[model samples]
Target chain A: MKEIVVISGKGGTGKTSLVASFAALAEKKVLADCDVDAADLHLVLNPKINYREDFSGGKKAKIITEECIECGECEEVCRFDSMYYPDPENEIPCVNPIFCEGCGVCVRVCPVEAISFDDAVNGEWYVSSTSHGPMVHARLGMAEGNSGKLVTIVRNKAREIAEKENLDYIIVDGSPGIGCPVIASIAGADLVIVVTEPTLSGQHDLLRAAELTAHFRIPTVICINKWDLNPDIAEQIETAAKERGIKDVGRIRYDTAITKAQIMKTSVVEYTGGAVSEDIKQVWRNTIYALG
Target chain B: MKIAIASGKGGTGKTTIATNLTATLASMGKTVQLLDCDVEEPNCHIFLNPHIESSTAVTTPLPDVDEEKCTGCGICAEVCEYGAIAVVKEKVLIFPELCHGCGACEMFCPEDAITEIGREVGIVEEGRADGFRFIHGRLKIGELMSPSVIHAVKIAGRESEVVIIDSPPGTSCPVIEAVKDTDFVVLVTEPTPFGLNDLQLAVGMVRALGMPFAVAINRSDVGDNDVKEYCQREKIDVILEIPDDRKIAEAYSRGEMIISAMPAYQKLLETCWGRIIDIHRNWGELTS
Candidate 1:
């Protein structure tokens, strides 16, 4: 099966809107929102969840209050500053779960055996059925760490569902920036669709994202969103893409209907019958064709 | 006072607010230091037009295995949680991009063959634009972690009297690292559903960190009243409201700070800054 991820170097380049429209156009595909930190695609697709599972991305170190001798050794060894003196009166040096990276260095350094690693439920993954096909998605907890692992879990679940349902493609809505979660999403994807804007920041981030895709030897196509704002920059981006040998898939102009559709909680294709929807449909077809 | 402008959602006007606020403060002749904490995509320099004085590489350590020490045990790879070290074909491969530089692999290598090595993950630039000192970071291509660079940027400008930070979009580690120890946080957001959802996440994060924060609604007329309703219900202060003006969009398109384009907004921005200072004062009293 072919796995395609729709990502942008930066966020708010109309990735979710385009991905939702692609979900409508794809023949047989399972969707995954690998943007676990701030996932919003489910708002549009409105998937009917079939199964939910707990995601334990890592362990959280907790202080055993009874055996604790607050020698402050854990705080000294913790590079993440997860271990802190919470109570000055009680002299209790405790672990903050949100900041803890579960390095296990504190556990070994604590002489009183006060620290113990416990399974941290960092997030939740869902197996849902959308209007298009089965979907695997997850939501990372607020102020929680280990988003990359949660993304991997969702991708694996999507692959398993695709195999069971005999699907041909896996459409992933990837996270913003070149971070751990983004890396997890793009590691095994067959193709990457980068949705970018014509602004300088957009172009800069696109270059970084393209460089990363090239490093992994993954083929990529660039789609310029909001191309009307700066046509000159758009032309420059196309030229740069040609020089870099990255395919210029297409461009989507700034359409008010896109935001209106998002407000209505529906894909652009479903919300309106207009030029933007047609443009997204064409992009999806070209992407599938390129994958083949 | 150190104030960070951040939102969990993108296109929520974090940069717009940050740039304009710094410009207004400078116009009033207040010394301001603006740090762009979005290392992956630092755009404050674009709007601020900072003349960079110096740039330096920020390096992090990765494990280098000695082949001659020659016990090809997979133990080093097994201990690494970041997947930076991998055993491939009887040899160890180090993917420096994935490495967090925890030094655990080197410490745990039983063969005493592993040593730490430095690799550049990003660059930090320091400069001045208009009247405000600026610091920003740009992550190296294919490098994943940004909180490290964000931390470096924040530390670079912490000594300033009034430091303004433009944080990356999201309520993740990068955002957290940018806002930690700030005297006040200005949460810039829109009035859309996605805005409300992510704003709540941001609120939860700041609260968990024991920080004082307020909200500024950008594009107030574009979506709905959910954000204002949320702020009211949560007793969160709504310090400022910027309308969805095409002039603002046009100025942003040309990489112009709004305060520079429309000088009238300077007074309004000063008011916003005053509100921030007042709220910060009240918060300090309440917390202490």
Candidate 2:
């Protein structure tokens, strides 16, 4: 089966909106929302969760205050600088969960063995039922690290469901940026579609995103969402993509109906077969053909 | 005070709000620093067009195993959390990209065969944008060490009276790294369903960090009123609301600051700043 991952380097460029439309248009497909930190495709797909499990992306260090040496050894060994003395009176360094990278060096250096490397419930993954088919999604907890690992878990589950059902595709909605989570979503995908806009920030970010895909030797294309907002910049972006040997698969016009459809809790294609829907359908057709 | 303008959703005008606010405050003769911490994309430079004075390489430590000193006992592999090291057939192989520079392998090696080496993942550039100090980071393509670069950018910037940080989108480590330690955070979001959803997550994130935060709604007229209603119901302060104007979009599309493109936006931004100061002072009183 082929996998198509939709990404946008700059956020709010309509990646989820397009993915929701793809979910409505595509056949024999299992969806994956790999934007675990701030997932929005589920809001559009309205998935009913079938199964879920706590996801432990990595380990975190916890210090036992009672059996403390407070030699400051753990603080010195922690490369992440996660250890801090919240109360100077107590003198024991507390591990700041947000700053912890789960490297476990602090645990190893604690002379008194007061540090315990414990599993952290960083997030949760779900196997859900949607109107299109089965879906895999996740929710990375607030202030949690290891989002890339959670993304990989979601994709693997989607792949498993697709293989078991003999599905044709796994369409994934990826997060913005060329960071760890975005890399995890598109690293092994069959095709990568970068949904961008006509703004200067969008254009700048698209180049980096494209460079990342090219570095990974992944087949990639571009979709300029809200292309009409700046037709001149949109044209310039398309020209730049061509110079980079990246295909411009589609240009979605700025439409109020798309947001209205989002509020209505359905895909644009399912909401209306109007002008914006037509534009998305064209993008869908080109994406499928490009995948082949 | 250090204030971070961030959004859970990308292109929700984090850069726009940050650039405009910094520029406006600077032009009004306030000492401000703009720290663009979105290393992966780093688009604040596009709008600000800062004159970069110098760029410092942002490097992370990677374990370099000395084959000669090694017995190939596989102890380093056991201690590494990232699985970056492997003893294949008693031959050590090191993957520098996977190493998080935590020094676990080198620290735990019985023979002390492993040594730490520098790996350049990005660069932090310090400059001057208009009347304010500017610093931004550019992450190497395909590199996953954005947090390190963001940290370097935050460090590289010269501290000023009002520090405005433009953070990356999302609620993960990179975002956390960019937003941490700031006095206050301005959660920038649009007024759509996706915006509201991501805003809720962002709220959870800032609340978890115990940060004093306020919301700024961009393109407030476009999608729905759920965002404003939610903020009001939650008793969260709505600091600023920018209407969906064609000129604002046009100005942003051309990489022009909103205050420069439309002078009236200057007042809006100034009012936003006033609100931030007031709210932050109140927060300080309560916390202290």
Candidate 3:
């Protein structure tokens, strides 16, 4: 199966919007939202979850106060500043969960062995059925990290579903920025589509994203959204992409109907028939042709 | 006062609001500082068009094994939580990318076999833009860690009377690093399903951090009123509403701040600042 991941180096560049439209256009595919920290593809697709699983991405250190000594050794070794003596008069230290990076230095350095490292339930994942096909998505807990591991789990599950169902494609909505989560989503994908706009930040972020894809040796395509906002910058972005050996797949004009369709809980392609819809259709056609 | 502009979803106008606010505050003769902490895609500099006065490389510590003094006891690898170090057959392998620069392995090494060496991850640029201090961090392409660079950028804004931090999208470590220790957080969002979903996640994040925050709805006329109603129900103060205008988008595409491109926005930003001060004052009273 061919796996295509859509990403934007900057947020709010319409990666999920484009992925939702692609799900409507693709014939046989499994949808995955690797933007696990703030998963929004399900809001448009409205998936009916078929399976659910709890995810423990990493461990957090907790203090066992009963065995604690007032030596302050754990506090001295803690690099994250999570270990603190809340009650100095009592001389008992505590670990602030928010500041703890879960590095376990305090647990190892405690003279009395009072610190314990426990697996943390970072988030949840789901295998669901949407109108387009099967979908794999996840949600990371508030103030939680380890999104890279969750993205990997979601992608693996999507691949499994695609293989079991004989799917032809897996369209993934990747997270923003060139971070660990983006790396996990881009690695091993058959094609990468970078959805960008015609703003200065858009151009700069797209270059950073393209560098990431180039490092992975992944073939990439660029699609400019809201291309009419600044035709000059749009042309500039295209020229920059061409210099990097990346081709432009299509461009979509700014449309208020795109947001309206989102409010109606459907992809723009499925919710409206307009010039923007036509542009998305052409994008899908070009994507399919490029895949071949 | 320090205010951080953040959105859980990307491209929702954090930089737009931040740049305009800083420009407006500077025009009012306030000592303003704008820090672009979104190191992965630092865009405040683009709109501000600052003449960078100085640039410095931000480095993180990476462990360099001392083979001469090493016993290969594997203690350094054992103490590392990120799996950045591994002992294989008397040889220590270090993965610099995975290292968090916590120095735990170096501290716990039984044979004093580990020492930290600097690894450059990004650059922090400081300069002046329209009489306000402009500082931003640009993470090296393909670099995974952004919090360290963001932390460095935040330090540069500490001396200003008013600091505005433009944070990266997503409710993760990078966002936390940008918003932490700020007086107030202005969560900028559009009014769509994706926007609302991500906004709710951002709200949860801010609440978890126990910080006072307000919401600003950009492109207010485009989508449904679900965002407004949610804010009302949640008692989240709607500090500002920036109407969708083609001229604004065009000016943004040209890398111009709204306060200058559309002079009418100056009054609007001033009113937004008023609301922020009022909210912050009331928050102080409630806490006190």
Candidate 4:
């Protein structure tokens, strides 16, 4: 099975939109939205969740105030400044959950053993059936850390489903920025399609993203969205990609129907039979050929 | 006052508003500092075209095990929360990428065999854009630690009278690191469904941090008005609205700041700054 991951180093580069359109075009494919921190593919695909699982990405230390001795050792050792004194005159401290990085040093150093480490529910993952195929996605809790772990879980679940159903491809919608979650999404993929625009920021981020894929030794293909917005920058991007030995797979013109289709809760290919739709179709064809 | 410009979704014009606002503030003779905390892709430098004054490498501490003094009693491994260390058959293994530099393992090591060594993850560049201060970070490709780099950038801009942080697109840890201690957060979003979806997530993040925030709708005329209605219902002040114009896009594609390229957006951004100050002042009154 060939796995194709769609990524854009910068956010809001239409990664999910392109993935939704690819889901409509590809056959016998399982979809995974690995952008768990802010998953948006479901906004268009409208997946009906059939399986749900609670994810405990990491542990958070909780201090039992009742068992506390008034010594301030825990606060002294904490690098995160998570220990909070409820009363200014008192020594008893409470752990602020947001600031705590779950390092567990407080639990180890507490004289009275007042701190207890417990599992925190960081997020949830779901396996659902969509109009395209089996879709696996997740939602990271607000302000929660360890999103890279959640992305890994979603991708593994999608790979399992693909194997069970004998699917031909697994198309993943990756998160923005080449951070931990992006690394987790791109590693071990058969091919990575980077969707970028024609702005200077777009060009800069695309280069950084290409560097990441090259470090992982993953073959990458480039697609320029809204190429008509700045054809000069688009040409520069193409030349840069070629210099890096990356191929340009497609270029979609600036189209208003892309957003309109998203508002109507459908892919661009399904909502319109216009020039943008034709561009997406050609991109899909190029992707399949490249994968082969 | 430190203001953070963020959007839960990418490419929604966070940089556009941030760079333009910084330029406007500098033009008004304010000591403005713009820190692009999107280390993964720091784009403010491209728009500002700042002259680099200095560059410093940001490093994180990774544990190095001393084989000579060590008994592999597994005490260090037990104390590590991230499982960054392990004792396998009288040998210690360290995973530098997984280490969070919490100093737990090094401090609690029974044999006193663990020491911290610096691992460079990114670099922070400080410079001047006209009269305003400009700073940004570029994370070494494939580095997982961005919050550390962002923290360093924030520390560099702490002394400025007005600091504007341009945050990465996401409501996760990196976004949190960028906007946590700011006076006010300005969320930039378009009016589409996807934009609204991510904007709501960003709003939840800011509210969870107990930070006062407002919204700025870019490409205001392209998508529907659902975003505006949602903000109204939530009682969030719509601070700025920049309509969809081909001229703006052309200027942006050419790497020009909207304030200088069009010269009309200066008044709009100044008005937005006025709303931010008003909201921040009221929020301070309620809290203090």
Every candidate's TM-score, chain A alone: 0.97, 0.98, 0.98, 0.98
Clashing pairs in 3: A11-B10, A11-B11, A12-B10, A12-B11
Question: Per-residue CA lDDT of candidate 3, range B1-288, in tens?
Answer: 899999988888999999999899999999999999989888888887899999999999999988999888898888787888899998999988888888888888888878889999999999888888889998887777888899888887657789999998999888998998999999999988888999999999999998989999999988889999999888899999999999898888888888887799999999999999998889866545
- Cα displacement (angstroms), candidate 3, residue B256, comes to 0.8
Q: lDDT score, residue A173, model 2?
A: 95
Model 1 clash pairs? none
- For candidate 2, lDDT tens digit of each residue in B1-288? 899988888878899899999999998999999999999998989998899999888999988888899998999999889988999988888887688888888889999888888899999899888898999999999898789899999888675788999999998889899999999999999998889999999999999999999999999998888999999888789999999999989999999988888999999889999999899889867556
lDDT of 4 by residue, A113-229 (tens): 899999999789999999898999999988888899999999999999999999999999999899899999999999999999998888999999999999999999999999999
Task: Give the winner by TM-score: 1 or 3.
Answer: 3
lDDT of model 4, residue A121: 93
Error of 3 at B185 (Å): 0.4
Give the DockQ (2 decimals) of all models: 0.56, 0.88, 0.78, 0.86
For residues A1-292, write the lDDT of model 1, one tens digit per residue. 8999988987778888888988888888899998888888898888998999888877788999889886877777677877777677887877888778777777766888888887889779999988788888888887887788888999998898889889999999998887677888999689999998887777877888898889888989999988888888888888888789998788887788887888898889988889888787878888877897
How would the candidate models be sorted by lDDT, starting from the highest? 4, 2, 3, 1
Candidate with best lDDT: 4
Q: lDDT tens digits, residues A1-292, model 2?
A: 9999999888888999999999999999999999999999999888999999999989898989998887999888887878889896877989998888898888777878998888999889999998789999999999898888999999999999999999999999999999889989998899999999998888999999999999999999999998999999999999999999999888899988888999998998899878888999999999999988
Badly placed stretches (over 4 Å) of model 3 are B284-288
* TM-score list, all predictions: 0.94, 0.98, 0.97, 0.98
* Model 4 CA deviation exceeding 4 Å by range: B284-288
